[model samples]
Each structure stands twice: as structure tokens, then as C-alpha cells.
Target: MKLETTHASADVASEVVFEAKGLKKEYDDGRVHALRGVNFRITQGEFVVILGPSGCGKTTLLQMLGALAEPSAGILHYRGKSLADLADPASYRAREIGIIFQAFHLLPTFTAVENVQMPMFETDRPAAERTERAVELLKLVALGHRLDHFPSKLSGGEKQRVAIARSLANGPTVLLADEPTGNLDSENSKKILELIIRLRREQNMTLVLVTHDLNIARMATRTIEMKDGLIVADQQVPQTAA
Candidate 1:
């Protein structure tokens, strides 16, 4: 079957980086349904927010979209291709998706640059090139000077920055962040939010963020609310001109 291609004007970004159809999840023999036929699409370079109360399946949906978890029943298309076609999803995750969690998840013993380079260590890139790329990513996150600092020496926000740099190391197409600001104070949360927005704008990355904060939801170009394992509301909000 031939796939349809709608010609988008140069001004318009790609239609969607990800598409989910009839997504459903069940655990404990139908006792718990985490997601009930959830459906959504994330456009290229768009900042999207998944907002809901606790146990609303927001994070579950995000994980499915990131390829970190599989949906019991659903169709997921990444960049218009079925995710199931990927020969090795671990490689796909490393190459296509960057994930950030509430926990910084940085290596305790490694310095910031070393943590950033960890993702690419298996690649054949020369050590010098890997170091240079790590430096560049650190600079992108405004952490070039902290290259030698371990997570123990960094504050909450700085550690998050290192995580962000590590995520960008492979230049992923989609960035999935789950409650990225949940662990930070108001000031640090704002800083992390700003950094996320900046990455979306400057890097043209597709962003899918899950959060319980309405203020954080309002910052995205699109806001989607979930409840009872289903999407309750989906809307595209106005964003500043790029």
C-alpha cells in the first residue's frame, strides 16, 4: 500500500513525529487498565504536554511513545514508520529517542562530560571526537565549565543539565521527558522548563513532556489532558513566532 504524502508548505513543520492509535494497556487480567485506547500525534518541533492527575496513564503513554515500554494493543508510528519494524529497539532508543526522568539518572562516579559521553562509548567514534562532542553538548546546556564536576558536586538544576546534555549526545529526533521538573524547587523548575523550551526551539526537537503542573502544561504549544486511561482534552495553544 502506498502511503499518502501531503505536501506541507515550507513554513509548516512535519505533520507528526509520532502517531498513536487505539493504544490500550491492561495489567492483572483486566483489573487495571493503564491506558484505554489513547490516541495522539506529536508534530515536529512542537512542544507537547501530557497533563493529568496521578495514575492517569500520562507517564505510561509517554513511555510507549518513547519505545521504552510496549503497549498491549495499539499502533505506534514514529516518523511515519511502525516502531515494530526496528530491528533492535535498544539501538533505536539510543539513536532516536532521548528520555529524561524526575531523577537526574547521572552516573555518580563519572564527571559531567563522562556521563554525557557514556551513550556514545560503544560507537567507533574516536576518543577525541567523543570528548569534543561531549564538550559541545555541555556548552549547549550551559555546562561547559562543569565538565569535570561529578553529580555529587552539582546542585539539583546542574545535575539535570548534565542529564539534558547526555540526552542530546546522539541528536535524537524525539525527546520524551517524564515529570522532568517534579524534583526541583520553583526556581530550578523554571530554569529546567526554560532549558527544555530552548532545546525544542533551537534544536527543532519533537518534545513530549508529562507533568502535573498546569503552569508547565501552559508552556507547551499543545496541551493534552488524560484521565481514567483516556484523553479528556487535546488542544493546540498559541506559541510565540519562531
Candidate 2:
């Protein structure tokens, strides 16, 4: 089954999904600045790739976009509302945003289907419905046959596929993936990238991915290059005719 598109007001649908103004992040008692006054906006249904070298703040910016961490300074808006002002940030994350990390992050004991069903536990859906949806998602990721396999029994690529399916469990409008291909081999990386691109096209989801691979960055609709905690360049990828 195909995933459903996110519902939104016309005004909200037309607006940018994420807007960051002078965004900054500091640590080590303000001794280290991870993100320095970065400003960017991600429009709805766009696939944006954040590209930078190590320690250049690409992951930090991704964290901010995913609501995994709060910015030390500057303003961040999600659909025209300040992220800090949200009444329930956890609920916002659970319902509106999905995050996938470099690590697979699957529970070792749970089967692939169980792992995918974990996200639905936060909602009020019945258990049977959740299992059905999880099964369907695993099939979408080409893991239908591995439903009963634990993480240890699966290959690295298969684990990542499970993670991807889990990320979509909530039908989020925005998907934030940070170095999703980092741990995969070249072949596996290509497969994962293609899967992500297909999902974005099929679901009309807004994708924000962080990667150091230029080839991976080239596949995005927009590429944002960062260096020394600042945005160095932002360019649109030229479209190839179908």
C-alpha cells in the first residue's frame, strides 16, 4: 500500500516547512560554537541536502530541524510558528516530524515488524491496526520476508531499511535523516538513497538529509553547503527531464 500524504491548511501547505534565522548552537560552556548564526528556509515537499565536512555543523543544523535539540540562539519556525512556542514539542515530533540517524537504532530483541510498530505506540490506534500498518511499511521497504528477524539477524542494509520504515510509521510531513548512508557499503548506500528518493516522490514529503558525499548531495532537489557553522552556499539541482 502507498503511504498517504500529510494533510495541511492551504496556507500552511504553501509556506516553508522550516525557517531558521540566525540559528546558533554552543557547547563546552560556550567555548565551542557548533552552529553560528545560520539562516535557511526549507520549503514544503522539497528534498534538501545539507552538505559539509566534519565539524562544519551540518548535523547540528539537522538536529535543530528535527527538534532533537533546541538552538542556543536565533529563531526557528515550523510552518510559521516558533518551535520554542509549541505547546507540546514531543507531540509535535511524534506526529509531524520523523528522524532517522546514521546508526540503525533498532532494538536488538524486537523483530523487524515490532521495531517498526514502536512508533505507533504513542498514538491511540488499536494494536491490530498498528501491526497491519507496520507490515505494510516493511513490505514497502522490501523487508516483508524479514518480519520476524531481529536486528542481529539482519544485514546492515536490512537494518537501515527497517529504520526507514519505522521513521515513516507516523506519517510525518517532514523527514530528517542525518548521514543515513554513513554505515552502509557503496552498493547499500546507493540502494538506501534510491529508496529515500522514491519515498519522497511517492509521499510528497519534505526531506532534510545531511551527508558528506557529493554524489548523494547531487541527488537532492536543493543542496545547502555549510562551513565553519555558516551556510556557504545554497543551490537548486537542475532537473533532468523524465
Candidate 3:
């Protein structure tokens, strides 16, 4: 699909934040195909919900977008640059992409502040700067009071809040979330979704969220539905959907 996009940045000068051409991922010696050559383009400033049932390859697609895994076939691009060509994929991830996993992947031994500071270490900022940024981000996520608390000491909602703070540690432009509210109760899920929407607008970040919940998908400006590893639907959401 050719999604014509107007350039959005003065640096990369591209509106297309991500483009997947014939993207594929296979496992178990090609016996299982997680993704079957799906293609799509995400533009800047878009709130995109990737909706599908479990095992529909939504998470696999998100992983490729985050550079957390490689595609078994085809290519993925960020701002028109191939992900495979990145000199340091870790550096790219830390600087350009923010990721929220389904599991709140917080370090049990590290405090919330310390966990938030982990991504900034990839940057050249001084310790004091990293500390300041972490504090700022935690406060942004309403977790400032829990800065000194470890993952084991926090509630599920609190821990996920810490994870959200950690994801924004390095100020990435692209935010890839894989079912962030899956572990939370209804109230917490609402809170988390509100926080995420507010953050995306405040930061003007490109958000590609993966979820099966139609309630969540309704709030998005766009939704891409996947089935058995192929994109079945991609459409602009109606104003009333939100």
C-alpha cells in the first residue's frame, strides 16, 4: 500500500514514521509463521491501533516496529531508512523508539527512578542529567512519589506506571505499545489509556498501539485489523468512534 504522506520533520523530513514491505516473521524452522508478509505505512502524528485476536501477529508486528526482533523476510523502515542498516539497533531503539510491553518489565532490584534512568545510559548525558530526566518523566506519569520504590513493593497499576515512565526515559518520537492495559483492571486501564493519550498529544509522538480491545481501538484515529498474520483492514476512524 502506498500511503502518500507529507513530510513532517525538518531533519528526516518524512511523514512516514514506519513502512513495512512484505514483512514476515517465522519460527520453529518455518513451521510457524508469526507474520505473513504484511505491509503498511504509518504516518507521523497518528494514533494507530493494531487490533486483532490473540496469536494474530499484532505483537510480532509491534516487535518489528520497535526493532526488538528481525523480520524473517522483507524489510522494515523508519523515516525511509532500513532497520537492518542501523549501525546500532540498540541505540536506535533507545533514541528513536519508546516501547511498552504487555508484561510490566520492571527490574525487581531497581527502584522506579533507577529503572527509568536505564535507557538514558545509552545517551551521552551526565548522571545528574539522567537523574533529572528520570524524575521528570516519573512525575509526568504520576509516579514521582514512588521513585524510590522497587517493582516488588508497588501495586500492578503502580508498576505499570513505572514502566510507562521508563519507556519515555529517552524522549523517543515513536511509541510502540503492546497491550499495555492487558494486566490492569478496568479503572486502571482507563487511567493508563488517558495518560497515554495525553502524553502522545503533549509530546506529538507517533503512537502505534497493539490491542484486541475494541474499546481501546475506538479512540484511535486509525485502526489496522490483522488476521492470521495478514492485514485485513486499515481505515480512518470516524469522529464519533472516540
Question: What C-alpha lDDT do the candidate models reach, one value each?
Answer: 0.83, 0.88, 0.86
In candidate 2, what are the lDDT values of residues 1-242, reduced to their tens digit? Answer: 66854555343455688999999999998999999999888988888999999999999888888777899999999988999788888888878888888998999999999999998888988999999999999999999999999999999999999999999998988889989999999999999989988987777788899999999877888999999999999999976510
Least accurate 10 contiguous residues by lDDT in model 1: 1-10
TM-scores for every predicted model: 0.91, 0.96, 0.93
Report how far residue 16 has shifted in candidate 1, in Å: 2.0
Pick out the ten consecutive residues of candidate 3 with the lowest summed lDDT.
1-10
**Per-candidate RMSD vs. true structure?**
5.3, 1.7, 4.7
Cα lDDT over the full model 2 = 0.88
lDDT for position 175 in model 2:
88
| lDDT value, residue 92 of candidate 3 | 86
On residues 38-150, what C-alpha lDDT tens digit does candidate 3 reach at each position?
99999877889999989999999998898888999998999889997889999888888888877889888999999999988888889998898888888888888888998
| Candidate 1 C-alpha lDDT tens digits along 1-242 | 11111222233377677888999988888899999998888877888999999999998898788777788898989878877566788877777778898899999999999999987775677999999888888888889899999999999999999998888777776789999999999999999889988886766777889999988877888999999899999998777622
Give candidate 2 misplaced runs (Cα > 4 Å): 8-13
Lowest summed lDDT across 10 adjacent residues in model 2 is found at: 4-13
Ranking by lDDT: 2, 3, 1
Work out candidate 3's RMSD over C-alphas.
Answer: 4.7
> Which is the winner by TM-score between candidate 2 and candidate 3?
2
How many residue pairs clash in model 3?
Answer: 0
